[model samples]
Target: QFCVNYKNGGISYRSARDGFGFELDWTEFYTTTRKPSAGEVGALPVSGGVINGNLGIGTPNILGGSSIVLGDNDTGLKQNGDGLLDIYANGVQVFRFQNDTLESKKSINVTGRLTPTDYGNFDSRYVQDIRLGSLQYGQVWNGPGFSDTSGYVITGIINGNSDELIDGAHRRPIQKLIGNQWYNVVSI
Candidate 1:
């Protein structure tokens, strides 16, 4: 049986079978004596409400398999059967979130600093080399056509090209420094 009761200045409706009912206190509604304007009759406020459960805008929650879906039917965020959160755009999977990992179909651009806590490896097949804008101090580079085995190093300064030295121990001619001059040491 359906019953309507007016008690304590409130109106309520109850179902006798399940004892489920709703009560509308008069003070909450009747306290505002002024009636709404023609435009405000069916209009809801833009803010000030708490939704405890899932909310769907243009599409239903069940149809999209997402807890919340925006106006577009193809775009939404859902947890897949694998327990991973997936983002969809235009009915295509764009991103997937796994354990500490985020996989994306498109490239990601970061405006701020992206610091990695751990070391990672890049595939040489996909990434040929890394280009940097500038290098810091104390860094060295090998010029083009430089070979490790055939490369030679200048030990000290030499006065001039005519000034050559003889190794006292080996009794052989070698490039040596006289005072503070520089010289080019060519590999033999």
Candidate 2:
């Protein structure tokens, strides 16, 4: 068991693998064989914030199941071909990272408190539409858009009518409303 000194003087229960990028207070960590049952394994806030439990940063599998594990071919967090971050809490995703960046530029190096509604969730087809929700949780991108123009690039609302345009553009909705809440998600 690895320990993290979370912001707000809060300590975290996770693994040493989660401590890769950030510094950790080794003394506060609770030594145990039990892996993190939820959230990123080592993505604690800087020094004084609460650890918002998310499945994206450290741990991959859902909690509660004894056999939860990182999927096959997975090397690190968000390394899956799905190409999106999965933020799960206690086995359920409370949020996700949907990148609208083009395949040529995959990482989101944006500044400030960026919200999912800011980007179109990696689908260039909807990039031009400012009126649409930028990103929704739970969705994933297979890869960059296909090389062929005949193959369409998708964004929010994978299988639905365009909200603003009168002409129906037939494409998959990259975003979907889960439990009536809009989240920038990449469906795997």
Candidate 3:
């Protein structure tokens, strides 16, 4: 069982298992409004598995600075400010999405490819020995306790020469993923 009481008003509570329950006394229901002053104490009870103190003011998205920053700094995710979702595959950026409204039901889908031509070091290689392919998205490909998605593979090899390098050519599916709707999954 759980209960909440307002000094000037009444009390309310709810039990576990059945559903939700609440009650208010006349004084508590339509009680006189008594706003809290600067140092006044206001108490509200929240119940779940454990009970904790009330959430104080300035208790929103708060964070410090970072050592590195990826994507556009003007619109990158902020720690103390806002946050954006960034996705990467094999040390490469894939997509990024921002959560501006703080909505409960929100999701972003990213689709892109990594190619050898994209990297700077591969240009010197006399012989291109790298190949880039689509990474299959299996049901369990992402997150824990999931299976692998086939069709995704990275290919390339370095020649014997000290300067020889491997290049994996990749092609971004521009037609399929060209729009503001497609999130920028770049990360630091």
**Top lDDT hit:** 1
Q: lDDT-based ranking, best first?
A: 1, 2, 3
lDDT score of model 2?
0.39
Per-residue lDDT of model 3, residues 1-188, tens digit only: 33446564544443333334444333222224644443333343334332242222233212223212334222223233347554333333345555643332334445876344444354434333323334322221123322222333323232334454422222222111222233222223
After superposition, the stretches of candidate 1 with alpha carbons farther than 4 Å from their true spots are 1-7, 10-55, 61-63, 110-119, 122-149, 156-164, 168-188
lDDT over C-alpha atoms for residue 81 of model 1: 62
Question: Residue 126, candidate 3: how far off, in angstroms?
Answer: 5.3
Tens-digit lDDT string for candidate 1 (1-188)? 23334454433343333335544433322224345543455544455544555667887664354356777666778777676898877777888899878899777899999987643343322433322222112112221322332224323332333435422111112332323332323456
For each candidate, what is the lDDT? 0.49, 0.39, 0.34
lDDT of 3: 0.34
Worst 10 residues of 3 by lDDT: 171-180
Per-residue lDDT value at 18 in model 2: 43
Q: Over all chains combined, what TM-score does candidate 1 have?
A: 0.41
Assess the local accuracy of residue 46 in candidate 2 as a C-alpha lDDT between 0 and 100. Answer: 50
